[model samples]
Target: MTSTPQERLRLVGREEATPAAMSWVMSLDDSDSPRDIIDALGLAPFVSGEHPHALSAELERVKPDAALCPEDARILRTSDDESTKTVLAAGEGWMLRVLRRTNGTAMLHVSAVTEELARTVIEVCSKDATVAEEADDTQVSMGFWHSGAHGFSRRERTIGAATWPEIEQNYSGDISAALGRLMALRAEDVSGRLLLLHGPPGTGKTSALRALAREWAQWCQVDCVLDPEVLFSNPGYLMEVAIGVDTYDDSKRKWRLLVLEDCDELIRGSAKESTGQGLSRLLNLTDGMLGQGRDVLVAITTNENLSRLHPAVVRPGRCLAQLEVGRLSPAEATAWLDRELGDRPKPAVEAGGMTLAELIEARDHPTRIQAAPADTTAVGSYL
Candidate 1:
């Protein structure tokens, strides 16, 4: 049994204290065992916050023979560099590893094991560097920041207020009209659970997500699931985000929207055959029955073809909306270009079937970008 001896006991401003308080303070006790001290103090055993299983609350294991609250778990990790070759060069404690989706890896220093500390460890390991520039606490946190230990971050993000209008101007006609109808939804009218936004690169997927954040700011807290790949593989990491045990600014918001950006394989065909249980977990989250009672909406963006998506994952009722952020039409592209060169013999340069992103780059360059870089295999592409 652990013990800390007390030679003397004193209380300041004891004038108003009760007789029992005075009696407790007056006892100059010797060392007491941890159990005796806990019993005397009437403190409950510490619990770990990383809820095992889906939402099970049972205390499965204890760390270090006792639990330490978050405030008590000292900060021992500083360097984010995950490479073992770098050598952290710091003292060791009960450390946990979290692999974030977008942000750098996270190292959690646990002084003692308890639920709060485990949750804190996941959070600390998952937290992205806070917004560098001054933006509102909510808006400033708008983007991906992964924790290496957690695989992906359950990081919250909502784009700044001023940027959405400017981003809207980038799209005209069909794309613009399609988005307008959805944005016009009344507070009580929203019925869908999953939003599938599929498109290729340079089609303004990131910007579109930002706009959605702005559109739903009044009712929803936008949370980014930074690492979709790891999200399926790691149950502990996935549960924290799925359960959303800890949410930001929940007082004002009625719902939370989770973003699984650039997740091609999670929704693609053969997902169950190849990707394992992650795809199933994702589909379950969007299910009408399975997703009941949870105030959350999932928005996923991918670069895969619309036809190739998994049939079960994209069933009619499961998805609230399926909007494609595809290449801009010729007329739309011309209109965008016309914004810069209004009515002065606009340079005609074969702009058919080009993405807005490609057009923007072409306008800036003296010549076109090199032929798609020879289609060489790069790291991190889904098969």
Candidate 2:
């Protein structure tokens, strides 16, 4: 029987891929010959121009039938003004692939087929550069993961997020002020590793997050975790997202805010009792030692009640800020609606029970949404 790729270990001279070795691993090229680009990148140490090298030997043993194995490699040519082309080898299951563009921005991709090995492999590789110095060039960044891997597709300066006043123009309660203080909270403000934003949907959790991201653009980089459920379950996945591989280790430790929204399953009161991946892993990520001194800050948005959150998560010194995002009052909603939707004759639009998202939707389609009936039923009110 043929062994699977996951069973193999990608060893480098009796050791796994190290940061320095990874830099060398990525420098390997196969554009001209199998691992041909290695010469172009001047990989004098990693490979030889010889026909059969250690790398090909590794591949050959793993995939005897070349037709059946899917080759994994990429060549990125980045030319803003000056152009450059870089190539790296790839194959399914424990392969070394380098994502390098013409502009010299490089990201290393190293994954083992199994979770444990993948974790160990990535742990070694990222101890040096997953995102690397790329963080310096990215002011505002956005990323998402699929099947446990992700990339920063774009960078932004402002993202055009609204300012405090613009976001809270309809605020009739103290949430806007609370948001002010929450966003203003700095590293010195608290010892907690997490921030909790709980409320109904459409209560401006997203807007407030944006405002905070923009407000703290100087030192904070907001990263919205697209898949919170798989984050803790996949060791290799979480390592990259939680402890970015390309992170800088300067005196001024860089910070990335991992924002998980609508994570009701991960922060519920029953989380502490469970041993499974859902809430338990999240608690570990937040309260466990791995999160203790890490420069990353966790932000979770959920419609679940704050009181229902596991005590371990919301306990003293664990959360930097816990803000309840509620909808605007009737009076505030009236004024806000007037601002959002041009002033018109008064309509009995019951805004008290409505969320900000609902109000905005109504405002946008005023013709469709009729005035509130004299007697309407209570909303389940997730927002």
Candidate 3:
């Protein structure tokens, strides 16, 4: 009778067999099959999984209690400042390998004699690692979605952003009032499913969105779609983002705010002719059959004027709020400059008044503003 790989592995003990297994794994290239490597190394019946956005501190806490194979450790210098580390360790009946990258992505592979041990270790590590990532009130947790070779994937990060109260004065009185009401909205207060902000670039549309994320951080999970065109055009990708699994606690279902920025072409008057099914898919995500019963809100920012946008997009009752984020008035600009540049000489405001970005640039470099040509556009004019 022939002895199986697992029976042979148990006879030698995992700790004794680890050095040889690590040597074999290190010899394999990225194109090699992982299962083949495991079988060749007598590590069958093993479980493997990956954890995205894994915290370094939590990984350090969950490292297997085993002897390290320093000789087989690999360090990949991804860039001048970033490096990826892969380490292998083994105990009496188990072998653990960890690959951690500088960007907070990590993968763990464990080979144990029993399936229960392998699953329990993975579950405990994932749960404990995520718990440590909960953000405090000062920071907002945001999810970013992108389409990769594997498909649409989401990664989360905690970012520090100014609260609505801190940046309320950055906008004109009318714009501020409109945004104040939008920011104060609770889940039950939501009437429509769309939030539209149309304006020229550099008027603080992106900044306002960030502040809105912080204000609604308690009841909403804000997710920014990196490629809105692909999201709307590809039905599969759209479905992945629209029907995302809610990973929050079951006690309360959290609403999702999907932010699509600089989507001028997708919602313009001729969008249907130019973008095909893109505009229709976006409408469906907001309030059409696709949006029924789903607690999802779509917020879009475009540089086009409200009149230039497609009628279907800005139709009444479809949007919760649609506000034009225009530049500040001459008087409002003067007040903002006075507050920002306390002792410095102020720059002359443009005839059409200055956008918030222009105000910031002027406050930071008053001399540059005075020397630049009158036709020169502001730094974020095309944002």
User: Among these predicted structures, which one has the highest lDDT?
Assistant: 3
**Candidate 3: tens digits of C-alpha lDDT, residues 218-264:** 89999999999999889999998998656567756689999999999
lDDT of 1 by residue, 160-243 (tens): 643455666566566666776666654576676788888788887777777777777677667776677877787766666666
CA error at residue 241 for candidate 1, angstroms: 0.3
Off by over 4 Å in 1: 1-140, 143-147, 150-164, 245-250, 288-290, 343-351, 366-383
The candidate, 1 or 2, that scores higher on lDDT is: 2
| Tens digit of per-residue lDDT, candidate 2, span 71-180 | 33333222222332323433333444443443324434344445554344444434423222233422344444444113323222224466665676644468777777
TM-score per prediction, in order, is 0.58, 0.59, 0.70
Task: Evaluate residue 273 in candidate 2 and report its C-alpha lDDT on the 0 to 100 scale.
Answer: 52
Which candidate order results from sorting by lDDT in descending order?
A: 3, 2, 1
Off by more than 4 A, model 2: 1-139, 149-158, 245-252, 272-277, 351-353, 366-383
Model 3, position 88, has a per-residue lDDT of 48
lDDT of 3 at 149: 50
Residue 126, model 2: Cα distance from true site in angstroms = 20
Per TM-score, the best of the predicted structures is: 3
lDDT of each: 0.56, 0.57, 0.73
**RMSD of each predicted structure:** 14.4, 12.9, 10.5
